[model samples]
Target: MISMFDSDVVSAELLADIVSVSKATLLKWEKSGRLIPSQNSITHRKEYKVSQLIQFEEVRNMINSNWDQELNVKPAKDFSSVELFAGAGGLALGLEKAGFNAVALNELDEDACKTLQGNHSQWNVIQGDVKNVDFAKFIDVDLVSGGFPCQAFSYAGEKLGFEDTRGTLFFEFSRAVKEIRPKVFLGENVRGLLNHDNGKTLSVIKSIISDLGYTLIEPKVLKALFYRVPQKRERLFFVGIRNDLVKFAKFQWPSPYYRILVLKDALKAGELYATDVPKSEGQSYPNRKREILSYIPQGGYWRDLPDDLQREYMQGSYFLSGGKTGMARRLSWDEPSLTLTCSPAQKQTERCHPEETRPLTIREYARIQTFPDEWHFSGSVSSQYKQIGNAVPVNLAYAVGRSIIALLNSIDAEVDLGSDSLAFNGSFHSRQLTLLNT
Candidate 1:
């Protein structure tokens, strides 16, 4: 990713943003010798010299990013893709921006289908359970993509293959690939899958990818914050090439954008949005809850409330272990928003406005997800929130989409595999792509 990281020094805040971690985690890395800042600034703040930080993988990638060149890339021909589990069109729209045309989109939710149809009348959206849909008709589509829900397999003390994963959403996705036989396919899911079932789940998935006659790229979670998205959302992406094309195709993960966007960019008129977030329907707390939340400051949570209020608000959760940082939480304008959930005001994941004492409005949620203001939703307020919250940030998808396009371009031009042109990751400012979701 071509980001603007020209300075010789990197601040603690900037480094933390680039690495997709908290400042405290940086401190922990320092203590463990995993990361060490070269020196402090004139104001006595921790600062890292970029030259000395190249020992880190993320830093090295950033310093050698080629995001600007990637952005200028275009399709060698009209490329088409079939998207499964196309929730609310976030991924489809992003891929559209990155130069892929949607041949067909499959969605199970009627509302999400309508959202996609209303926004893009030209799209062929098929609404129904994917089990009933056949992909054999859409042949040679170039690419197939899906954000399939992560489900564990029934392990039998043996390695699993394609049929072993029957009855799961992932199987349906694999079935699509089996039928369409696209040159490439992309799968996305929560980062937690990296360790689900103690890593056996991922192991089985690897087996299935191989069984499907594709070569799986080493998957990585890309952080939205580094992709010009103003929310701390992350999604794990898996890109694979058809076995026949594996010898010729080179797939590189997208590099990170230079800057980290925060809540202020999402809600106010700035780089991310052309205007302040438009007022709309949103969830509200009862009088007592609002009163209690008002006591919390921007970036503070229930712990910041008075002791009595904390007991009243947290109830049994108060006695629970772990930080429970999401409780009674108020967002900070200067920082990216906490990962949003299906509902904005759940007791376990309270995301109050940075200044206002209310949950984020539907429009605000869309803004944080980097959905354009004009891309209207087609559901009740609650459904809209769920759709927006569940979406891949449009910008994040766009960034990855660019990299996918680059890979396709390389394959089409029959570019030399020995050249850096097929790098898994090109030069960046040493502070680029790894998305995280909560």
Candidate 2:
């Protein structure tokens, strides 16, 4: 096995993709001498040795974790959650493990709804758009959660109101929370949402959330890597408390896992898994893509291609300044995976397996997201990928769920002294409660 310390060279496009930065930013870094670019003799294109990234504090921490300690925290109270945009139940399943019984799960995609229903027939999987659902049915649910799509709003008026965001899915999320009036609400979105539109969009979201009678805690972008998932995906989380409950609503975000998980831990029988990843249907690359990817090494991308092939594969993008690292990329077993996109073998964001030259299989994809082996996905292979790729990593959601449960437990005991609460080990706790099992 090649050590992660082995000097890695990648194109500007790949580095940009890795850090979610722009090529213009790379140039800015270069100008500031924060980044030094090297030329690939063949393409004469600039590449950067990954030595700087390797020595980076965060990267170093990722590669050198014990990852040996396992934490499966349980809930402090038997809370119920109503999930919107519940894709294939990744977040739902993890939250269930943390002890939130899902009373209802609403999804727009039929395949994703079936995937949820197929796995857990008892779940009330409501199929169709968020706009159609009457969330009033789930009244007084402990929590309402969803990974709503982000949309830009018109700032035509001086202030953005809850109604101003009417056309966007986020508006639907806010609407559901308004109707259900849950004690707590969790909204998830892509990390880009944190800074979308010069921060105006997030500011508007915060304003709308506040206007809806909830106290919006400052949103945080949680990195999946820190939460025991073997991937580098980032999701922005917004936790809000019902206005009346804000004083006592102490919501602590979940703690990071003991160590970072890697692809090996995910796919093999190790810390994150009890058995090898099960074989299943998957997307395959065409002969040309397969042939092209064969030349790349584990953790390598298009820059690893031969000069002519680099030009051939990249074409016009070859001349483009960005590294486009997702193209013809293969993951390294020793490190956490780059985020999995909807289409694994798509031209711009391929997720080829480490040892094999094809895209990751369905089960492999699930494992990387920390889904249990017995959990079955129902849909065409492509639809399955869409479900899994778009999901919050199971382990990440579990960590968040645990924290939410802790907060709810505290409130239950404080507000109603007779309430039964869950102990750290899943048993009952006392009225004066300690939050996390920390």
Candidate 3:
């Protein structure tokens, strides 16, 4: 047998660098059985076969060709949607651009509601907890969407169904879906939710979605970099079509853009934006932080710091085994920006500007999220950061939104042809016999 830890086994870091993706992307690949890893005897760290690296590189190149395909994304007819937890309108705005009309937007955050109202005075910005609202009044809606926060559920000897999640926000999202009975629904969350509670949580979510009479598509965590957004944020998106509409609609995910975008495309006048980022308020680094970060070269991290400074900055973490890649990290203009954090200057997640040593300004953060320069965030600076950081990148949402539109169009056309039709999700289409009954 070949040696498990031979030179052919490559650490994930080397493979990520070789393919120009993040370590997080590599982890996802490992879980999906794309890049199988074996333990290195000397380091006991994850390593992959050299052949795997070449395979991934070829796939990456093929994705670049997909950017040229024209998407027939126009809304087939006037479609309306209701959005829950509409923070600063990132997802809502993107869906609107993809041609869904926003009927009403509900958000508990006062600042977020104000931001929505400020941006669109005519919008019905409902400011209150989602639990108190009744969604049935919003009839004839084609879609219901929300980026619900992920919370671990308490499994106390009960079946994980719609009622089991009563205490959590997901229950509220499900309730809205049940009451409104939209043709389709969308739910977005952090990528970690996929493996949360050893994947039991996601399994339960799918069950509840089925219990509510919708066919939940196999969930996917989409990397923002694969879209037009110049950031590496990843979001887990679930698209569920009503059982009645599934046979008529075949959902296809939005294709990746022709090219990967970089931080320069976000900050400067480029294909993504018509003008350079505007000057805006931003957080400042303390004197001590400024001194430490000044030494970090663009795209470099704490390892670049002197030994003493690294010890002081990382505290006891310096002795830790894992690669603390984000510590004192400075972004490079040529690469996609790392995922934005709720705060730009946290010691562990310092996103220093490529040219400037300071943290990126608010405008830059918005730009990285593919938020238009003119979109104003209403709140304290920190709150503004939180809203943007928590949002789905506008361009990524737009791409997915277009895919949903296409599915809806197909469903509409099929309905016109035959009153009783069926649709399926991704490639996990249910058997024709069971699909009709469901």
Candidate 4:
């Protein structure tokens, strides 16, 4: 049983047990000003008060809650979206901001589905494998969007079709688009997809979309930092229009925000928030690792450490050729953080705090990904971290959502104007020049 004491001072070990954190992390929090110790009225020794712990419920509850923040801004237009492979609710929330209602969302992870439902009970979340669900039942969606994993297709013939691309997640995603036949579709993936299988993978994807009677746009990679997310994330975007309507409308991607946001904007009450990041459950480094990282300066990496510590931290990889940028790295408050991974403390891609020697907490991870403060996550500490890291940054998804809305609006306008006015043939360039000159 836990004891509730009043005005009594407790040691770091006691605080660690109460908060379920390590002593090293509690010490680091003290140094970073996140958690300060109170002086005992009589003893004059540093100790944490029980009242202080109770005041941080926002952080404590985050261990098992999903975030749900209302959008403060107004929407430019109204549209509807059908999302596939929805993980956590980053993309869904973003699309909501662009004035689109999520008619349906499909996700395989049960916890992620719970997170989505916990926040937005009205959302139609299909919790199962995409292969088991039939997308044909969902009709009249203005747009179909997903961040499908990139997979290499077996090239048995010159062209890949829906039947030839079996046993791959991409096949399921494409089949949904073919069945629903929405006015427009959007697909996203890691930037490496551009060069996967020597570019054959992307080529096959384009061919499949074309065969489904859609006009594929030249895919481009969008940098998240440019779109108001405080992370240097890059994702490949592929947009397509139903071929019948392609000649009638043109689409443009969203423009970058005026300024790039940094870590300070994400975690604290500044440009991106109204208050400091709430305290929450977080992972901690071992004693030895914590002491070694203490010497690393903000915005510095392994090179900033002493000669011996550098080689020790890097191990045999120290002699390797690549930049090894993530090793022993500390983030800078003024710059976007590196792309987050499933595990915050992994040696290969450490996302240490800007001012502390520890990794970012669960709440900090959510904030950097643009999740609202109220959104709660369920599961163990490690599982929560994995869900947050795997999600798309909400702001980045909102930017893409705005572009989808614009395209849908154009399609609606074209349809209202009648087919004759929007018709385009081989003489499109000459006709456009004539209209401009006239």
Candidate 5:
């Protein structure tokens, strides 16, 4: 997954694979004069080198990244954290990899609790509603983190504050930070949070975070594709430092992996996994549906089918506006998977296999989410799907965790020296700017 390509010069097909686009799409780009490639001297076939492809952001990031260096980051001291809404330990496991010790994890779902406790018996798994659990007991924790469910706030007026957010799950997350009084807090949510309720929801959230005596860093949505997860999932992350320690916090978002990962990397015995995806049960389409989907090509959707089949399969959606691309969609092996939903065979968002006619198996879904093969899910099939779907991808979480570790390390340096002069150059400052701007 880290070393994305074997050769410096690659064919057009390989280039398409690297960028997670179809070769036909590349042809279209060339026709539109967006991208024009050189031909190899001997074969006279289209070829591109890393330097020549710098115009493409994906290729440029792959060339500029310091992913190997970032992986070497280590915690300066024993940092402890308390996690709320810890579903099946994806975030917890990733943070653990990044050197944070979980002091406690709160989850209301019994199956998710079992998954957490089953995987790590030593974790102080608090299996109950977060509203009932008191965070006051946790003292001197380095971080308090969670992906609280987003609920729109009731509009009382133009400005909304902490008390105004009382009934929402975001308030509970804010409450934990208030009680624990950690040096820093981390929150994550879907990208929709940015525009929720026409931005009022996020405005209230920003206000509440400030009301709790913390300095909220401008929130950013991190793409899983840039973090070595073989899926195009995006999550909005909120990081805040206690006002007293805000001066010490010099945080940079995690660097992109040198190369993006695709479905081939996930399911095959390659950089991402030790073996091909393990066999497991998965949802299946009915006979008629399967027969209809059999006609669909890789990376294609309902529109790829014959006219009669398209009308039969899409029903009234056949006449709908917008590109109903997810309907009857068959994933491409060369591209990262579409963002995974709770189920594989949903009518609105079908996730059919690249070559096979059936839906992806449970193991395939877990692999795409970057869950370790050994980690066991602890509930019925549907519950397992729900837990994994709700989780932040493990690799994405690990990337964010490393950035947090760097931030904490900087704080430590500041505390010891009593000045900003001891600032930790913990980020890929030069490289990050280049990739981000592009």
Candidate 6:
């Protein structure tokens, strides 16, 4: 048997560099059974043993070399998109960057709906429950997109179908996909969806998409921080292509940006924007809370405070294990903001300004998510933050949009190559099924 700890233990940072993956990705892999790290019994800190590293040739190769390259390219063509659950338009705006025109957007929240319409008057903003809408009405669309909420399916039999999933938001999303039958569709959701109900939810989702006559790509969880957005947000993205088109194309995930964007870049006039984040309505901590937080330095948290202050601030949570890094946290200008919760002022996930003693304003939240400055959010300041927090980062969406366009372009190429001839034959349906299965 091979020794699991033949060499010295390596820190996660070094291991990430050695493996050519982000620290977060390495951690997620550990959690997902892809990798296992040895733990120091006394300190309870994780470390990758050198013996374990030697087991993976890929990591050993990266550890022995150092090289970085960047790619620059433009979209081949301008594609069109119809988005559902368009919160604060983060994904919508990103798709726009990939050269996709937003033809229609649908969201149930009155404020988010208003936000979408207010910013882009040309867009058809439909505000209501998705169940009430008829997506088939929109024809000739190139892409259909949504960050649809994931809900458990009522499994009546071994396999789930379109009708069996009724009453769930995913059903509406699938309904739209079935009705519109666009060239491609993109679905985004929280990473938890993968393990929800012990992964049954995702399994059913895959089944339904397959049954609906689309080719489901291997679902992937994309981290926003890796894609240039400064936040540590992760979302599961599902890509589906029309059955007839899958065999004709290959799709690649977007490459990560060379440098990470940090809090300063978001709020200050820098690479992310031309000017500092515009002053706008922001939530403030109470006088007592503000005084307590004043003691924390930029990037510091409750642990930096005196014992008395830490006790008072953390209260019951102080006794709990695991780093509650969010408590009394003063965000560092050099790092990405922790995932923004719907409520910025929430005690568990406080996203305070680096210099100031206040919650990030609605505009700052939008900016962090990469929503263009010109984009306007509607409803109360609180509602606006909720919409922004719940959204997919715009840049991530753009990257995914580019991938969709590439897939579509590949399909077009195949058509030109005589791979998809328009001949009415008994084999057409079977060929479509075969393409989808691939």
lDDT of 6 by residue, 69-136 (tens): 21233445666788889887888888887778888888899998888888888888998988889888
Cα error of candidate 4 at position 28, Å: 40
TM-score of each predicted structure versus truth: 0.87, 0.81, 0.84, 0.78, 0.87, 0.81
Model 6 spans > 4 angstroms off: 1-78, 419-438
Off by over 4 Å in 1: 1-17, 20-24, 28-60, 156-160, 415-438
Candidate No. with top lDDT: 5
For model 1, where is the 10-residue window of minimal lDDT? Answer: 429-438
Q: Please give the RMSD to the true structure for each candidate, in Å.
A: 8.4, 7.4, 8.1, 14.3, 7.2, 7.2
Comparing candidate 1 with candidate 2, which one achieves the higher TM-score?
A: 1
**Candidate 2: Cα lDDT at 408:** 84
What is the alpha-carbon lDDT for the whole of candidate 5?
Answer: 0.86
- Model 5, 1-438: lDDT tens per residue? 224654566668556655668878988988987776789897666776665677777777777777888899899999999999999888999999999999999999999999999989999999998889889999669999999998988765226567777877888898899889998899999999999999988888887888888899999988888888998888999999988787767898898887668899999999999899999988899999999999998778999999999999999989989788889999988778988988889889899999999988888889999999998898888888888888999999999999999999998887666433324443545443353223
Q: Tens-digit lDDT track for model 4 on 272-324?
A: 88999999999999988888889998777888999899888888988989778
lDDT of each: 0.84, 0.82, 0.83, 0.79, 0.86, 0.78
Better of 1 and 6 by TM-score: 1
Prediction 6 TM-score vs. true = 0.81
TM-score of 5: 0.87
Q: Score candidate 1 by TM-score against the native.
A: 0.87
- The residue pairs in collision within model 2 are 12-323, 13-322, 13-323, 13-324, 14-323, 14-325, 76-422
Higher lDDT: candidate 1 or 2? 1
Q: Write the per-residue lDDT of candidate 2 for residues 253-276, one digit (tens) a residue.
A: 776553556789888998878888
Kindly report which residue stretches of model 5 are placed more than 4 angstroms away from their true locations once superposed.
1-32, 37-52, 156-160, 419-438
